[model samples]
Target: MKNHRKGHLINKGNAPYVLLAPTILIFVLFMIYPIIRSLYLSFFELKSGCYQFVGLHNYIVLFHDRTFYKSLFNTVVYLVIQVPVMILLALAIAVLIEEKFLRGKAFFRTSVFLPSITALVAYALVFKVLLNGDHGLINYVIELFGAKGVNWFYGEWSARIAIIMAITWRWTGYNMIILLAGIQSIPDSLQEAARIDGATARQRFVYITVPMVKQIILFCTITSTIGTLQLFDEPFILTSGGPNNATITMGEYLYDNGFRYLKFGYASAIGYVMTIIIFLLSALQFKATAKGDTD
Candidate 1:
């Protein structure tokens, strides 16, 4: 029995690691390997389907590429236009739905969030049909209001505006659900105390609710920023990066290089550049929010 006990003790030290081995292996295989491989590939270019070391040549080409700049511009527009509108709309919807006396809120909330659960491709197709230039349902409705229907995918600015609207439609409910969770996590007692102090509704919200939930708000903002910057599905499915490259985003441009044009090296470089951009933006946002908190 003493020998058996000693054997068990010997096995115990490595048992936890043995159980954790599969998870660690999977992470290394999928996450770590891809990152390392992509970085390595970024420094080489394919010629006649064979990779040749090119050093920083691919990155230099990326910086000078007109399409790359166009994609970066579209991505920034998505981040600036869609993100704030969605966040503000979500906050408003969350506040309205969180009202305890509101009736049938469960059904209403579920309906609003339904679009988010709809597959990206599926909803993108739906929007494409609805936004069709000549006989779309949306255009048909606008005709009833005595306004001429405009081709949504026709021009650069108009197409981008349509993209913004599509993004807002799809994501507002998702952010609303997040903000609602944040609202419910706040204590009721502080709200009640504010009411007793004769605080106006707007004042109470600005001072009490916003401050308390700023962390969650910050999280939603960072996530939305990342999502907007990496946006692909909608542009790919709805516009195919568009009639004149107007709606092309970084992801689509990357896809165009890696697969369509078979420029794997340049695509890898773009992917790394986008990764750096995302990291910098996220860090900047975090630092700014931290400063606000300190004040």
Candidate 2:
């Protein structure tokens, strides 16, 4: 009986693989399989509940679609404007929060980070109401100041601006918290050394602090780039990509095709194209930052 029990027990040599089997299975099923399936499906069109193979047709059509170009352009606009402004704002706030002379550091840090935790749908709805042309709190305040209240969503630029503002408001604090952690990790001894060597506050920050936190900043930038490129909820809720599709983003466009219009193949093509763009852009950023470091 003892010999049988020993034989039935698994060998320790194989124990790690046995323990990892479930996780590996789940990952293959949920992540790897979906990615492979999506790539395969991108080459086929859905008709009458059946998939018809149409290799490269979806990709060809995607390039010619004016709406695709519009969404891509709009996403580029957001990427160009929102990312830099949010990163800079976060850096400034993080530096201020780390200042030794600052009062109520805990309270201020919490206040800054609060918006990042708010539900995306809820925040988008709130921004929509606040930016409403007729009865919004923003318009009301503008009226109080003796200026005609602007119809924020009626114009193309205005609608884009409203979305950008909402994105920044929600994310800036989150980035600030990350940047603050990076800032805090720097040795106080370095700053003290710089100060003792007749470095001004600005010089110390520019030279010592910024250099130490460069990698953290790079990490934040790459994540922010990915997030901005994949942005959807804010514009979807706030403007419904309104006023002539002025605020429609690539992600929203993909959602529209996949869920709204039921063009699964074309949507899958868009998804892969976006995947390529994101990869290229991230690679460029990595190359640029690395070159800067060398120089």
**Each prediction's whole-model lDDT (CA):** 0.92, 0.94
Residue pairs in candidate 2 whose N, alpha carbon or C atoms collide under 3 angstroms? none
Candidate 2, 256: how far from true, in Å? 0.5
Worst 10-residue lDDT window for candidate 1 reads 154-163
| Candidate 1 off by > 4 Å | 1-10
Error of 2 at 237 (Å): 0.3
Best-fitting candidate, scored by lDDT? 2
Query: Weakest 10 consecutive residues, lDDT, candidate 2?
Result: 4-13
Q: In order, what is each prediction's RMSD in angstroms?
A: 1.7, 1.6
lDDT of 2 by residue, 27-122 (tens): 999999989989998999999999999999999999999999999999999999999999999999999999999999999999999999999999
What are the per-residue Cα lDDT tens digits for candidate 1 across 95-129? 98988789999998998898888999989998889
TM-score of each: 0.95, 0.95
